[model samples]
Target: MKPSIEYLQDAIEKLGVENDSKAAAALKISKQAICSYRSGERIMDDFTCIMVAKTLGIDGMEVIAAAQMEREKNEERREIWADFRKKFGVKAGIAGLAAALTLGSLAPSKANASNLELGAISCLESPVKLYIMSNLAWGGFSSKQQKCW
Candidate 1:
């Protein structure tokens, strides 16, 4: 991998520069410019790269290559993320909506009535009640009837 600005900063500190201000002073640049370079917010020019490398006693090409690698990696990651969103965004949304609908259907609706009894006794017509009544003729001829029971 190419050397990042952070790597260069570390090299500078190893060479006895205390902080960014000191490093910038060594390179004859503003502290803000050094901060921007360190943060990768601004690109370092070839001349500046060489100056920084010379100050830190390192090869300038190494510093430039590292910065270029970082920039390229950042661009590649952005492209990959954009492609992923384009490929899956609509499908993911539709899947989420379908899951919500299925779960909603599985849950009970407040508007529908339930057959289970509450505290008070209530009469509700049922097929089992009709069948029981038809099967049982409770009278003197109950035993003589066919075995509907």
Candidate 2:
């Protein structure tokens, strides 16, 4: 699990808040709570993790699971939380990739329009096309027949 301070810093940076006090206000928490999170004296609660995730535009479950893992005392329960984090993180990544692909396909260029048609056909034909397209879009090698749509 990532440290609470890291999450706090990320929220502060991503929210463009000037200080911990401002971040606390934005997150609807006390400044002292922010200080406790920064000092690792306390892990964020589920609500705070959700707020952080919303601020970061990430999956709330991923952040919640990470916090749960950090707070769990039992090793087995910690592992469960870890598993939840991994699962939700992958789902969130896939959703992000899908959104990017959809946006790219919306470009006004004719070439992109053609790719959009190809992508629609591929989606109808095989779910595996999503995996291939995501890889190619991220700079993976692709054959002419496997071009990312």
Candidate 3:
């Protein structure tokens, strides 16, 4: 897996930002936060990764995959800690395992909106699909008569 730093650098370059501080300004975040994301000290949330992808004119799934890599590494560390706690007692081990499982379950799953099946584009979120349909429904014309397509 390519490091998060590579993705961050590519985004920063694509956005024509001079450095992390400038990139942070463009994204309305702190430079330190950007640095942390690059260093894998913090994982980027889904919406933030999507916004970065949008800003960089790249696919959001790529950013999501990179962030998932970081999250998986962190999850491994958590599993190791849980295993170490197993030596204390069966109850403690079960509790640790349960906590790990709960945290893992909180990660985002694929959206399953039934009415949003647009063939190959079904992978996008339902709201985004709905937004596209709503905008395109007027035959490339907006409510204000603006061209939307």
Candidate 4:
């Protein structure tokens, strides 16, 4: 509905695409991308629309809802995935922005990445977290006594 340039910009920044090149690189788009979108010369695809909507925390159905069955089936899955990946996205965004600004790794998927399909977080992945869990489980550790005592 509201496809203003300012709205597009806000959406772009919120999605961690704070600049033209970064936006183009991340979305595999081109310099004409934002211009086209803003000038009504081109239409953004479904995925970008969803991405923008999710990042901006806005209603995508303002145009057209994906579909009833797909919506119902994917809603829960999306929520769970969002919660888990939020932190990763934030960290990746920060590092990614630095890299992008420095003309380093523009795209994250190109460098020896694979799909692990993990359902849970690993311990070594976050030591501080697992350390707290370990302490809670073992009650306490006495380095001076050099024993569980």
Candidate 5:
């Protein structure tokens, strides 16, 4: 079972939300992530937990412990990118990507629904619609249902 959205909601509340910017401010992450975390669709990561705790002036270890009991929680998700690269070779435009990250974490699948979305169109074969999607280090982008040709 995962922690309830209320857990994050409570954490947010502890920080004393500014109301109007709740959603926008939280957009420091993806809307899907916020919704998923808040709705219990996914668990909060350690970075988020720590942020919440720090904003609330509480202890991170304590929050993580409580969060863990209700969810299959883990620490930061930065490791997911490295793991993805190890599992699947980076196709294109990934040369300086890992270097651009400030938090040492890669952003989610960036190129989508555009020319770059499919990488090199000619690189793909005819008679098959091809699109290149990066694995979002965390839960957004919904790559779970996709099957590449």
Candidate 6:
């Protein structure tokens, strides 16, 4: 399971700051909040998770799930959040793989024909999967698409 502190640490590191105070300033939070997060006294809120995700260039849902899991007291609830994290992680990995394959196919080489086909398949498959999952989860496509884009 990905910890919320790991996300906080990654955000600070990505900002190239050596101290918590500077990280707090960059993150728009008090140093005490940073300390609380680092010390595991507090879990990041959804907004803060989104901020961290933006800083780390990853999906906000993954960070939000991690934070939610960290904050949950019930084992069952925590497991649900963990499941969300796993799903989001898989989605991010697939998106990354698809992007890599797509970019690789862009390279000038006849040998990349098969890769281009695979990339195209992945590109189409990812959205279809996402659409199906979103429909099942939310019961409609309109809201999710609006929020995601």
Q: What does candidate 3's lDDT look like per residue over 21-109, in tens digits? A: 88998877788889888776888877667778788776676666666655665777645544533443455457779999876554345
lDDT of 6 by residue, 26-143 (tens): 8888899888888878889888888888999887888888888988999999888888888878888999999998887656466655545545444555645334343657566677
Per-residue lDDT tens digits for candidate 4, residues 36-110, read: 776666566556565555556655532123222123356787455445345544665787688776554232334
Candidate order by lDDT, decreasing, is 6, 2, 3, 1, 4, 5
Candidate 5, residue 36: Cα displacement in angstroms equals 0.3
Off by over 4 Å in 6: 110-149
Candidate 2 lDDT, 1-149, residue by residue in tens? 47545776898899897888889999999999888888888999988988998898877777777778888999999888788777776787898999998977656456645455544543456655334345556767657656655
Model 4 residue runs over 4 Å out of place are 4-7, 15-18, 63-149
TM-scores, one per candidate: 0.41, 0.67, 0.44, 0.33, 0.37, 0.70
TM-score of 5: 0.37
Q: Candidate 2 — worst ten consecutive residues by lDDT sum?
A: 127-136
Q: Global lDDT of each model?
A: 0.62, 0.78, 0.66, 0.53, 0.53, 0.82
Which residue runs does candidate 3 get wrong by more than 4 Å? 73-149
Query: For residue 18, what is the lDDT in candidate 2?
Result: 83
- Evaluated against the true structure, the overall lDDT of model 6 is 0.82
The prediction achieving the highest TM-score against the true structure is: 6
Per-residue lDDT of candidate 5, residues 1-149 (tens digit): 21335546775666576652474265355666776776566777777777666665655654464455455334344344334334333432253464565323322254453434343443344567779875665654555555441
After superposition, candidate 2 runs with Cα above 4 Å error: 110-149
Clashes of each: 2, 0, 0, 0, 1, 0
